[model samples]
Target chain A: MDIATQTETAPPPPPPATTEQQRASRGATRPGDRIFLGLSRGSGIVLLVIMAAIAAFLTYRAALALSDNTGNFLTTFEWDANAIPPKFGIAVLAFGTVVSSIIALVIAVPVAVGIALFISHYAPRKLAVPIAYVIDLLAAVPSIVYGLWGALVVAPNLTGFYSWLDTVLGWTGIFEYQGGAPRSLMTVGILLAIMILPIITNVSREVFLQAPKMHEEAALALGATRWEVIRMSVLPFGRSGIISASMLGLGRALGETIAVATVLSPTFLISASLLDPGGGTFAQNIASKFNEASEYGRDALIASGLVLFLITLLVNGAARMIIARRKEYSGANA
Target chain B: MSTTAPTAQAVTPDTLHAARLPRWTSPLVAIGSAAAAVGIGLAAGLHSRVQWGLIAAVLFVIASYVLATAVEGRRQAKDRFATSMIWVTFLLAVIPLASLIWETVERGSKVFSPYFLSHSMGVVADQDPGGGINHAIIGTLQQVALASLIAVPIGLLTAIYLVEYGRGKLAKAVTFFVDVMTGIPSIVAGLFVLSFWILILGFDFSGWAGAMALSILMMPVVVRSTEEMLKLVPNELREASLALGVPKWRTILKVVLPTAIGGITTGVMLAVARIAGETAPVLLLVWVNPFINTNPFDGAQGSLPLYIYQQYAAGSEASYDRAWAAALALIGFIMILNLVARGIARWKAPKTGR
Candidate 1:
């Protein structure tokens, strides 16, 4: 009777005892635990510091370049940063970068969304897996290889198409091709469209695959056809995913260096016709000019690189924002 | 669009009302449209296959819609149009991918002899070109290996913190910046390293400098992928190990890591493949040397991508052949890595490998 009374009196002793034991065992200040935690935490901190360092170094160098620039940095198309009384600007680079990437976006997004739908919905089970795998491997092809092929094979083959466009759509001005080898902004855009295809397809395909089976079946049972089912069920569900995927591809097209460097027969002026071989991208400009550039010239390239950096950051940031905002976006559980 | 089946056959049963075009309808229409496209392409004197493909795509979509509308109804017409468009898009993508691989193999094969792999570019001129990638191969292997050595530990540790112990503002900042870092252009990474290592500190051109830039490009990929892999290790394992009186670190080291090792390794390999073909950064930091360079710390080194770019820029038949061959080598390396990574993932699970 005494022992039972004692046990009842010491009610819930194990809870407090366990808490104390856990505190003692998992020690707040044990050297090993503290050190391990600190080291791992320190690694994360180091990554942040490295990012900060990149921004700082680039900003400082860019500022130095701007200080030496004789012409308006944003307006002038001239790139004589190495010349005496140097005058240079990023106008041409920015223009080409935006124009080419926009072209890539226009060309790639719709096609990518279509291909994603085909892989996710239209393809037979066996065909879909193998096709997706092949596309993934294509995505792994290096930019330099693309550059070589673009310069040699694709460039020559594109001549017929360029001439055809010129003859058919000459009134548009943008399609007016001079009888030169097809090293133009249009060609770069097409190449980038091809290059970014796999990424957009992969992302959009994943999103489409995640569409709710219940929703699809519901649409079908409502007497909707296959395309109607996709329109009513899958399209709305994967909209944000497709947008972000397109944006990621845009980022890649903007920053692409070697391929553009190899394919474009660059001139300093921004050509009104994309079929003409003129204008320069930020990355391509930096790379093509780096070897012969003086210190100030490199700094100028760094300034343009800074602009490209900021642009990509904004694009990727917007993508992340859309992805985050669409927390209720995916319809897999609906 | 009218419900033609229901209205036209009011006396018929609902079974007739819910009819769709037969499965064979699509295949037959596709073949018919393709034949028409070929006839039209030949008649119009269109030499490019791309034009023929476009015509076929257009014809197929039109035929699908027309046939489906005639047999089924308007809703089925729209459905067939979408399916046809999607299939056309798939074919469009396949054109470039198939051509790129075929052209590379067809052109690159002629030059990819064992002698080409083992020889150096020292004695051969760009115009006179009989040379190999022996030097570039060594440099690429060393630089990429060194980068992995430095990046794996730091990236792995950072991922562990994020998955296991991350809680407050600092962790949030790290996550945001890591995302930002992943999108940082390769050129910017090269520029940053150039300023920090060679310009500010007066270091000379070397493979180590290139490695530094490559590591920056590589680190975020490693962290993101490893974080995913580590997160996949269930908390039950951690709790179970801790309940047995194992230290937190030991529990993570023994149990969590072993579970996630395959995925982490795959991530690392993917990162390797990404950085291996990087040319812009290598162009800036490591000046290419034609001779065999065993030492990456002290002098210029040849790299495969740089070799491709340099050779292509030379604009000679011999140089182009060499460039194609090097490109083939680079593509081969990357594809093999990706395939192996896929194999490892499949080894763990038949699905969800990505």
Candidate 2:
């Protein structure tokens, strides 16, 4: 009786002891554990530091360039950064980037989705496997190679098609072609469309393949044709997936550098017609001018790159947000 | 309201008949569309074969739908339309990409010789015919090696931390930033290194500067892929090791890591392939060299992609051929990497339930 009373009166044995024991059991007391943890955690911290450094340094250079700016940074159309006063702006860059990427997304997304569905659902197993493999291989083809091909082979071949577009869609101001080299924003858009196709198709194919098989079977059992089944079951389930996939493609299209640089004959003016061989994307502008750019000129280019960086960040962040939000009701967790 | 016998008979008849089109219907429509398209092209004096193809595809789709509707009703027609559209789109996408590959091989083969492979652009002018990518190949190997050296260990460790020990806010923040980093433009990455390493630190153009930028782009891809690979390691293995009184670090290193090593290696190689093709960073930082310089730390380097870009910019028939040849080499290198990575993945896939 006395021992029991003494144990009961031991003042709960101190809560810190439990946590300390837990920590020790977690291997916190061992040097190997502590060192490994520290190393890995430090690596994570370093990665974060690098990301932070990218933004910070870009912004710093951008600030230096912006402070001496002799033009409205967002609205000025000219880009004579190497001049004594150094007047430069991202107006043409922003317009070109957004417009060309929009065109790419517009041209790529539907066809990509169709191709994805064809591979995932419509194609026979033998054909599907090889085509999917081909797409994957295509994805690995370097952008520089694509750019080279676009310049040499594709760009020359596009003239006939551009003329056709011009004749048919000439009433639309954007299709007016005062043709010279066929190196224009429209060409960039088409090439980007081709570039982003594999990525979008790959992602959407995976999503379409993951659509609940039972839901598809349920639709089929109700006498729905293949198209109706896809409409009622697969498309609904894969909607958010398609959106995120398209956004990923858009992000790539917006930031694609060498390809745009190779294919676009950039000028400062944003022509109403996409067929005009003018207007500069941020990445393309940086690449085309960096070789000749002075120190301040480099900073001005960095300023433009900073914009491209922020735009991609926003686009990618929004894509992640969409995926995250959809995960809640996507039945994926279940 | 109808009697059960009549309703059942009606359903049976409808199910039995269902108005199917013959298998040859599609081929017939295709041939018809092609002829019609050719006739239309001739009549309209259309110069572009692309226009001919487009007209044929449209005609095929429309004709198939109309025939299906006439024979098999609206629902089957809709299905036929969708099927034809998907097939057309697939063909549309595949044709241009195939042409790209075909053109690369065809043009590249004209100048791609052992002589081209063994020499460098030491004496050849842009318009001259005799030059090789030996220097470029060396530069690319060194820079990619440097980038992989920097990226792999850090990326692997970061992924290990996230998978094995990550808990609260720091882990969350790291994960988020890794995603953000993945989308950083290659050119932007170059700009960052330019601003920090070159502009502020007063560093000269070197392969080392380019490697730093390439590593920045490579690190995120490495981390993401390694994280995925690490996550694939079953929890049972880790738990079993811990239950044996092994320290958590040892368990992760000896048990979890070995089990996941194949996938991790594949991820690293794939990351290497990706960085190998990067041109913007090299363009910005490495500043091209025509002659072979083995020392990346001291001087400008010649890389395959940069070589291609420069050659293309030279705007000569000879340079264009050189560009195509270099592109072929780069593509072959990346394709080999991808194929090997995938081969490893298949060979070392986790033996679940075996």
Candidate 3:
């Protein structure tokens, strides 16, 4: 056929030299290329402008609140938004955010890693796909739904567990329950863990699945068992991914609002015992009190929001750095 | 050498057979012996009934594992056990999702009649609480639609600029800020809108304020999704359009937009869904009202999320039913949107490869 002849002749054509010929045919500064380059260059510039504008605005407003504050912005515990000469600090909020997020990361990371391992290494193809789909669905479940579920279902169920923890781990201040029926930092942590589990699992599963098959096979061929093969081949490859997933989960937990606000009984005091139920996270306190706050009160809350924004930025920045370093380890040319 | 090979092979057969024998047998036997020992020691450390249950469960598991290994060998038994654990995990995930949906539907079924859909809370009192969520439903649609109108264009355009034209300092700065925006708590968006529009712009309790709050939360999602989808619009396609003498902007609008429309629409719908169920922002921006407020620029409006929040917070039995009903409505709406997006994506996905 003519098609077969053309295909046979195609490779014989001097296609490589045609590009050089075209370059000679067309001079530089063609309008088409110029426009293309301009548009591409322009987009990046626009993105920077938008970011600068936002930062400028936030900084302008934040400065208004920080200019006259008496206490150290980072360490003072009291958040007296209603004071005549309003004094506010983020120590308690910062503590709550960090503690809750740390708890969430600790509780979720292992289970998420386990689930990811199960999906990537253990489950059959058909079953793994469906389970992964289900986790995606969990990730898409609205935060407000989680909040409602936490308030209605999870909080009520915590009473017996809290009592059991008090009985068993009473000597450990962290688990000592102070007889509060429904509201505790432990409850918030559990809720946050559940909320963030899907994200970590989804990310970590992808990373685990991407581990080189040859590495796994080599381990197995060396007489190692399946679990040992996974331990050696997959876990090491996905360590950075696990760390990134945890940081992503931590970012989410640090800023989660509705669920924590609905579930936590925040009373503006930090306690070593998670069961003592008396701390307010930056996001939760803002959500709980922002509507009723006066002008100065709103400013105080804005100050807290600034802290949260910074924390999330720091967490995500750290994650990005870890991922960048991991690319180097994996020799990803990208 | 042949004679030596035969002797070596003969010696290896015993060890090879032992290796091929059920690896799980030893563990099962060890667990069985441990359980028996625990049973004998149960009286000293624990209550009789709990200890007996624990002992019985452990003994039953060990017995099953032993029987399986005996009948089917170690590999099959181990595979079966691992498979069952996978099923257990899947079931654990499914149970909560199924229960949540089942409970919502079951509780909300009482108020899911056509009359409920058509009628507003105009006829219902706070105490009576027997009417529908027409006001909240309408407010949800209008305000969310308005927010989409505001957010989608700006977000999509920003994404376009970032993908097509952005570079240098401006692009880097925008990327950073958008990242920051992505992490902004919903409440902060609410507060931002509240302070900016209400205090500074001198507006009070308008659905516009709610739209603003929702838009702030929605923009980052829209931008991220759009950016991703636009990135997927292949460079070859743009080059092809350019080769045909299409202007850059025209190529983006006509060729690139059409090419990526499926994903863009899905992303936009997802962003809508993300903001639609938001309560904290809506609560801070819009005033609660049972009556329908059709105008976003005007007075107080009630949304489904706000309705659920208020009704649930009220804690009255009747109001609780309404709260559940509204929750159901919201979930149903989101589900329908997701299904529609999926359907559209399937229908419009470009055909490739014979």
Candidate 4:
């Protein structure tokens, strides 16, 4: 009884028409606000639903290929998808994708970083904008154009380089040439590198440009040369961004189709030598076989595509995580 | 900010002091001038031999400018060197674009007559490959339009959701997945559609399937571009609309969208241009029909990209010419769309006081 009386006495000090209560009462009937919130929430839900649907559809179809008896899908190399028992696997495709993309990264990253650094630090203001524009134009060039150019111009020119590599570095398995004209993994890698170079360069240039001017000046003031200043100030600040850019380029290279198909003449075998003119990527296999594929053959190709899709997804996801963590490095904020 | 000035000042002093020393400055300039003169004389002699005087002169000028920069201090020589480089970069970009355009126009001029537009490729045979791209043009329009219809709304809505309401786990997952989708190869997308719709579901090669494949490529681009444009929309507009008791979707459609319409159109046009040139995916999913098919769900249909691919694959000189013509036509269409997008952006951009 005493507690109840004390509580009542204390609460009675504030009127029934308190400010908070009045505000809450007034907010309850705001149908317009509720409607807006509902719409926004509904749109988000719809996006989630669509993503779920895509996953469901892909998994449902992928199941057909996965259910078949094969000695695990990743180990076997023969893509005799038309066999009555259908013995097939993705080892060649996986090897091809990883090898080509790795080569592309190896070739593209250094040049891309150099060009980015040149543009951001060395080039004068008048030259910088135009160079940047050129890079943008390069990025906008269609993949088919690049493929056509690669097939006609680059492939023919690579024959000389391939022979040179064979003559010089033949002891290393990777550079050993089996005397193919020009259709080889090395040529494909070069084409992939050219295709992805613009993207990596553009992203890295933006990141490098965003490096703190004061930090650079500080390094310079300590008697560091221009290159040393860049090394001390820009490289550390933009390292994660450069990684993200390379990952994005790698993702694109891994999944590129027409260019790989046009440039590579695969013989359905894997070799350590990039000059062997063998091994097929998932995208290249799908493109080459889709025109005349039988039913089971199509399913097998789709299964390979599923693997490619998952790999690209993993790569892009990692890129996004890196980019997200290093958002401050991006020039957009500046 | 205040601290930055001292370091900048300190760095500038040593470089400035070194620059002021004028060590071997006049001799360096004289030697550079002499080298330039010799180079010009040699180039002129070669030009006389080759009958290319203009090329020689331009090369001489470039060589002189580079030499001047090396001999002179950067402050005196940087401008000319930088200007020359800018021009070189511009030329590098313009040359291919111009060559591509010129080659296409030269080849396509043979078939740019009115009848070429009216007649279908059905009449043309391998023996005499000179009918028209009428069927291909129609098929391309229909398929790309259908792809846009499928991709645009979904992509735009997803972008809207991502930009406006997305916050936690689902949004991050969707963003990550969309990035993955963006990197997917066009041929693989075709394979996915072909296996699912044709092989498993027992459907035939139709324009609908081709559109589906294109949508797979187009969707992520549209979503990414639209999301970027939407993000550029100011947050104050949303708050203002919300304060005025407007529904969120309505505000997005009316206020946010109108504000970003210019960028959105550009993004959409770019996406269309991107998918329109896809050959591998359409080749895999849709059969090449000689005649036009209006119904996307019906029989096979021809598209510009596939037409070009087929003609080039024929490995004949005449067919290669036709391929170049088709390439021209595709480039023309994309350029027109780009021009229109630019025009729209210019028209819609907010006016500012002069």
Which is the leading candidate under lDDT? 2
- Per candidate, chain B TM-score? 0.94, 0.93, 0.79, 0.78
What's model 2's interface RMSD, roughly to a tenth of an angstrom?
1.1
lDDT of 1 by residue, A216-314 (tens): 999999878788888889999889889988988888898899999999988899878998788889999999999999888888888888899889888
TM-score of chain A of 4: 0.86
Candidates 1 onward: DockQ, in order: 0.66, 0.73, 0.25, 0.26
How high is each candidate's TM-score? 0.93, 0.94, 0.81, 0.79
Candidate 4: segments with Cα more than 4 A from true spot = A1-55, A69-72, A171-173, A176-181, A221-225, A328-334, B1-16, B19-119, B126-128, B244-248, B339-354
lDDT for each residue of candidate 3 in B74-151, tens digit (9 for 90 to 100): 754565454434444445456557766777788777677777776677767766757778888889999999999978
Per-residue CA lDDT of candidate 4, range A128-158, in tens?
Answer: 8777766655565566655655665557656
Better of 1 and 2 by lDDT: 2
DockQ of 1: 0.66
The alpha-carbon RMSD values of the candidates against the true structure, listed in the order shown, are: 5.1, 4.6, 7.1, 8.5
What C-alpha lDDT values do all the predictions have?
0.86, 0.90, 0.74, 0.73
Task: Choose the strongest candidate by TM-score.
Answer: 2
Rate residue B223 of model 1 by lDDT. 97
Instruction: State model 3's lDDT.
Output: 0.74
C-alpha RMSD (angstroms) for model 2: 4.6
> Which window of 10 residues has the lowest lDDT sum in candidate 3 chain A?
A1-10
- Per-residue lDDT over B1-354 for candidate 4, one digit per residue giving the tens place of the 0 to 100 score: 999998997776554443332546435644555565557668656423222433443554465455556654454354444444434333434444454456567766765666766667786764365766788888889889999998887788778768876778868777776776777767767766776688668898888999988987888888898888788787777778867766566778898898888888888887888888888778887889978777878989888878876766666666666666777677778767766776776776532212
